[model samples]
Target: MQFATEILTSFLAIIVPFVGVFLERGCGIDLLINVILCCFGYIPGIIHALYIILKY
Candidate 1:
């Protein structure tokens, strides 16, 4: 379980910058959405990052 969380944290950390790029490219998503996701839960941030990567 701890390993899983570490993997998730690493994944999200890597994805944050890519998310910024997508947001900058005007993918039609708001930065606040990712910020909110981060605040709410790790899973949301992960999901949001994956979505950004796949979508943009």
Candidate 2:
């Protein structure tokens, strides 16, 4: 069950970047950073999202 949720979040992270982080952490600094990263480039946002998702 946890694995499935992680997988889904990972998919969302890759597809939409900060959205997964937003779902996981809600409105906060991480989400803000991710949004900024996304504004700069898609890859950074995806990377940050995956890191945050996997780490916490």
Candidate 3:
């Protein structure tokens, strides 16, 4: 159930970028990098978010 919620949050994060990660992990360097990646491109941001979501 939690995993499903996380997946949904990750998908929704596509719109705002890194929001799901931030919500999951809170403020940190990883979040900063995600924000930067999001600035570069949406795909990178999504990839990074998935990595973070699955990693820990």
Best by lDDT: 2
Model 2 lDDT, full chain set: 0.96
Off by over 4 Å in 2: none
Question: What is the model-wide C-alpha lDDT for candidate 1?
Answer: 0.58
Give lDDT: candidate 1, residue 40: 83
| Backbone clashes (count) for model 2 | 0
Residue-wise C-alpha lDDT for candidate 3, range 1-56, written one tens digit per residue: 99798778777677666887898789999899999999999899988888887787
Backbone clashes under 3 angstroms, per model = 0, 0, 0
For residues 1-56, write the lDDT of model 1, one tens digit per residue: 95565456456446674354244444545556766777788667667666664454
lDDT of 2 by residue, 1-56 (tens): 99999999999999998889998999999999999999999999999999999998
| Model 3 ranges off by over 4 Å | none
In Å, residue 39's CA in model 2 sits off its true spot by: 0.6
The C-alpha local distance difference test score for the whole of candidate 3 amounts to: 0.84
Among these predicted structures, which one has the highest TM-score? Answer: 2
Full candidate order by TM-score, most accurate first: 2, 3, 1
Q: Which ten residues in a row have the lowest lDDT in candidate 3?
A: 8-17
